[model samples]
Target chain A: MRIEANTRRGQPVTIYVDGTPVQAYTGETVAPALLASGRRAWRVTPWGEPRGLFCGIGICFDCTATVNGVPYVRTCQTPVAEGMVIETERPLERDQ
Target chain B: MNPEPVHTDIAVVGAGPAGLSAAVAAAVAGASVTVIDAYSQPGGQYFRQPNPAVDPDPQEPRPRAGRELRHKAEAAGVRFLNRTVVWGAFEDLRLAAYREDTAQAIELQADAIILAPGTYERVAAFPGWTLPGVITTGAAQTLLKEQRLLPGQRIILAGTGPLQLVTAAALVKAGAQVVAVLEGASPGEAILRQPGQTLAAVWGQSTRLKEGWQSWRTLKKAGVPYHRGWGIIAAEGKDSLQAVRIARLDRQWRPIPGTERRLEADTLCLNYGFTPATELAQLFGVQLHWRPAQGGFVPRRDEQMQTNVPGLFIVGDGAGVGGAELAMVEGQIAGLAAARQVLGDSTLTRRIEALQPALRREQRFQQFYARLFTPGPGLDELAAGDTPICRCEGVSKATIVQTIHAGADTMHAVKAVTRCGMGNCQGRVCGPLVAAILAQETGQSPERVGQFRARTPIFPVPLTAFTVLTTEGAESAESRN
Candidate 1:
């Protein structure tokens, strides 16, 4: 979670993750918001194992989630947008 | 939809210390310079910027330095293409990129190219490493540095090198309860054994020593345990990290049998070292030589940082595992050298020659760094049977070992048969891990196993990006969206 009292941040933005609204700021990426909102498993693999932000950078695709109908977008690289719906659980269906 | 390829006298593939400095030098030398970086902003990881809202950090100097470097580049007529992915490098210095915001496919035809692609943290696989809360030391540092966020309430920094102390100190300052910092190698012992060489390596690097001292001071104030000759064996948890199992290690880093201890923590930050980002340079037909201590398979380059391929130069950690200071010096030299070639002017030769001393000093530090921090060979045997090696495909150590034993000895064969490197990450994350697995199983050195053959479109590109360029047509060149 952001150290709200200590740090200055962009304007507040709300994005839905698995149908739950997550509060974020304008300048931050989706990965931080996702982790801050208490969602660690950004994506559930085909084996049903949980994976989160292994490499916060874009190199690892482990943090990919469906963002506003775009499947497999890296949350670590993607910025948080207002009212964006991020679907993580039913990821396989979106890809198909 | 600029159908006409973007033309530039020099094209740089990163915006880190090396690339930024190179861009500034070349542009200042009367050459048109364009740099492309995957990040939304300049200052690749080493000089990674914090949120613009955050005040300049007193402990971290790189972010402020990065801002100045970017400004210097801009003032020198260096154009930056941020948030652009260079997915492919083709013949005759051509590059294919996708602009994220505009959804457009772009191409670059350059006179000369400098690659400062940088390094990615190398992680050794252990049981539960695939858990939700286990992340690399670099990842955690990115979280704290860039986003002003922490991965968990209580974090354990387990890695080799000064990065462990640095990350722990950062975590502590950010209000997280840092449980401990477990250094894989015995650097304290290293300093004691080679005090003279240590002084030589660290002689010119006062700021580095000061930074290490500051981190130690911060950890000491918080009463955080800084364990040398120790490291984590595995991360243990249900869905996320609940604890880390650690143990004492011998000189080779093999965990001692009776020294097992489990420390409760919500997050586990792990790193053995790093791998040079040689994929892009390799795809550009640059020859690679195995330099394990330099983070494996770095591109071969001349003193001027020019690769075997004419007009192509690679610098910084991308060429080898040298730190940011070395990268900047090399960047300047390469920039001056490349600009001299393109503009048909030898006037910049003196400026390039002057940077040799700084470059040599940084090289000395780099060697000292490798000797002190590079973990023992025992790290290669970290993965257990069920431990996942291929993070992209979820391929396990058991499957990989079996594949190697079944005569899939080569890196390519193992990848092909088991789908090890065939995933969204395109083998970047799992390539090193699988190579180690293959080597352990076959009793061959990782160098003998070779690397995964990189192809065009090294990074995954969305299909829709292509349609935008095609639909816009060549006549509507320079369409900004």
Candidate 2:
């Protein structure tokens, strides 16, 4: 099978969630991989609550986090790259 | 911060046959086009399972047919976003979509929008259907189509729909011993629905039928027992499906008391019919009409496939459940029509008109199959008292019956009482079954069943997709509890 390696080919990377830096393989979708890496909660629900990945697919949009300087990247589908800074605790208003 | 919505001349939702054709046609007509779809690859369900060995890669030149058309579209610079889905549409043709890699919403303002979102396999409820081995014919087909894997060695393909026949045939081709196909339609009834359908099945597939007959003549030659008027009363097994109990039905299609028979099988595939992925269309607020010919409610469109919303066209199964050929032809017509609508080209309009006959023939043929393959009345007979009506919520037939008897006349009432349709899948799979039961219980028509309540997040979006602390969460009580 000619595996179409994800957009980011074998590039080692370190992604920091909050202030903790952890090594991760390249081309891994952020959310599940981060959870696999040991982080559990991505954000707090608007009503001063905690919410994790509710819908792994893009439909729920619950796994959003800041990638580098850009906010609102769906961690589940976005592939990781080298030196990518991921911020999970910035309070932002819901789109709805 | 709200990002500025990107503006494009034409935004085609879905990259299946219809959307692709529309995008190509619009682009060929000199309009900037953006084609978005959910799949990581092109080709919707029909062409979805193209074997890597069979399909051409991006580097390779186009396949034998339609090479030039695709090349022209590519040269015309149509932007193909393979893994994007249109969440919904707002007034003034604003399309809300999300990329596959990032669920982050993207907005697009389009002068014209064509929805070719296609259809999904519809599953009705039955006992033990949520068991591991119970899966939709479409799901099994996906396994075969995408991964080239057979579902099982011995399988029973059940339910009423054209998909059952084709899937049984495909599974057999993929080296499976299909024990039998439990068609809900009585033989005479199924054959009778064919003639009024324009003789499409016979004329269109005569060559293939001839081949299939010769190969399986002995199987049919001997009384291998294909119960003409029968339906599955219950699916039973532990951990996985080991067998299904079927019963013969009377003229009114009720299961006879003593005719119940059990068949040994590993996998049970079922499909009542399919419904168009109308989320986007409904979001656009396009007028829709219930067409029994097309399966169920579909967007209202003219012969050219244009919806009431000007510059917005629909094609393929999304328009109605015509097969791939029809989808392609409709795509061509819609593509051409959208092109003309954008360019106001009389020549293109004439060309589109010329293609209408073929498209109509295809639709008529589908109408035949739709009627022939429509779910038989036997479904009411098979939802036995013990059968679990809602697989996701594990609500049983007896519970629903109790709810119905206690004055819960509608599906919504049943849901309000039993919480059957409140699961993540909404009512996509079990809705039709519950509707059938409710209609049967109340002596109401099936149309009334259409009022089943549906919840948001229709698709089974993985919960893992949204979480950041994936490891810690999944590693905790989730595994055991």
Candidate 3:
């Protein structure tokens, strides 16, 4: 569970995670917003092990998720856009 | 057709304190400057500003110094290309970058380039380090500084360096239960080893000393236990971090036989120190020298911050792991020198000369800190055969050992055989560890084992971003013929 540390600024926006509508604040990255909503594991490795936010910066690329149809978008670096869709799981090949 | 490359008097890669300072100084010296950074915003990592759109508390004050320098740079007409990753540095000081917003490839040619790519946190591998809640201390700070988010309810700040103290204080202030702050170096030994130097360093840097004292007091008042000469041997967990195994270390940093203890913590923040992001420097064919004090292999720079390769300058943590203050000073010297080199400005010489004393003082402090927190021999033994050394590839210690035993002697050969350093991170995360392992196996120094040879496209860029560039390449080739 994520703790709210401070009052978030900006208008509340809805971002879809696995097609589920989740509330997110503007100006926040997808990773923190997902974490705040208690969704920590963003991706399963090719080995099928869960991983998330090892390095919060873009360096590690551990927090990558499918955002707006782009797979492997670094959630930590990509700011949340209104109505953005983020998928924790990699879409199947046919979906591409 | 290939678009004409954008030319600038000075191109600064990275917008951190060092890059910002350099850009501002260069622009002020009447050189047209362009600062390119991968982050969406300026300030690099040290002065990371919250995203205004998503920041819940916009009123929270950001690092004023970095912000001020950024503004000054903007006012001085420094062009900033944010969210732009310079993927390759090629012949004639040309740079290829991918702009995130435009989703296009851009080329830049600069008379002089200053690389301040900064550093990334170093992690000594141990069992369960790949767990979800196991993160680097810098990662914790990034969450707190950028999002005001705490890593976990209960956190253990483990590793060496003054950063651990600062991180613990920040965690406590952010309402996280900091279970303990572990330091590999004994405070008494650190001071005793260089009494006169330590005293002089503290005396010379009164402000830093005061800040350190304040952080100490804050941690003490919070009743957080601070353990010196102790380190995390391993983290224990299933899917996420549940606890960390800690042990007291001897002078060589080897764990004491009877000092093993386990503490429950959802989050284990580990950071031995930092490794300089020198891929760009290496790609530019600039010479690198291993100065254990400077973290690892760093680009060799002269007093003016110019590398052995002409027109390529390096500063900040990219040059070496000197902290922000030294980085800023070095940035100024490099900026002024670059501007003078390009613009034939003689007046900038005095300004560069003026910063020497402050630079020397900061260097003295850096040397002291490097000695105090250099990862000890015990850290080398943390990763067992099963421990994952390369997280990106899931290459284990056993795999690396097997590869080495199969006659892969150099880092390059091992990388070729085991794919150790060929990850999304470009080996930034595991290069040092692999080098250390190779050194241990061969009974040679890490420098002799060597670093991975940097190749073009230092960072991964989207294939789609290159479509236009591919056609442009053909056109350019035809035109050249």
Model 2: docking quality category:
incorrect
Q: Native contacts recovered by candidate 1, as a share?
A: 0.82
lDDT to native, each model: 0.86, 0.64, 0.84
Q: Write the per-residue lDDT of candidate 1 for residues B108-167, one digit (tens) a residue.
A: 878999998998888878888889888888889888988989889888888798888988
lDDT of 2 by residue, B1-481 (tens): 2256788888887766676677787788787888887866566666552333334432212222233444556788988776765544556676656565554556677887888888766665566555545666765665454444455556787777555666676566556677887767664566665554445545665644564464355445432345566777777775457888888766655678999889988677877677776766655556778776686778898888888777778888978888767888888788777777776777897778788777766766676667556665655555557666664456788999899999999888999899877754465556667877888888987775664533223344434323322222222111122
Give every collision pair in model 3: A8-B56, A9-B56, A26-B53, A26-B54, A27-B53, A27-B54, A28-B54
List the DockQ of the predictions in order. Answer: 0.73, 0.04, 0.59
| Candidate 1: residue B344 Cα off by (Å) | 1.0
Candidates ranked, most accurate by DockQ first: 1, 3, 2
Q: Chain A only: give the TM-score of model 1.
A: 0.89
How much of the true A–B contact set does each candidate keep? 0.82, 0.00, 0.62
lDDT of 3 by residue, B126-233 (tens): 888888888888888888877778878789998888889988997887788999999988767769877998887765787677767877988999999999989999
Find the 10 residues in a row with the least total lDDT in model 2 chain B: B472-481
- By lDDT, the best candidate is 1
How big is the positional error of residue A53 in model 2, measured in Å on the Cα after superposition? 20
lDDT of 1: 0.86
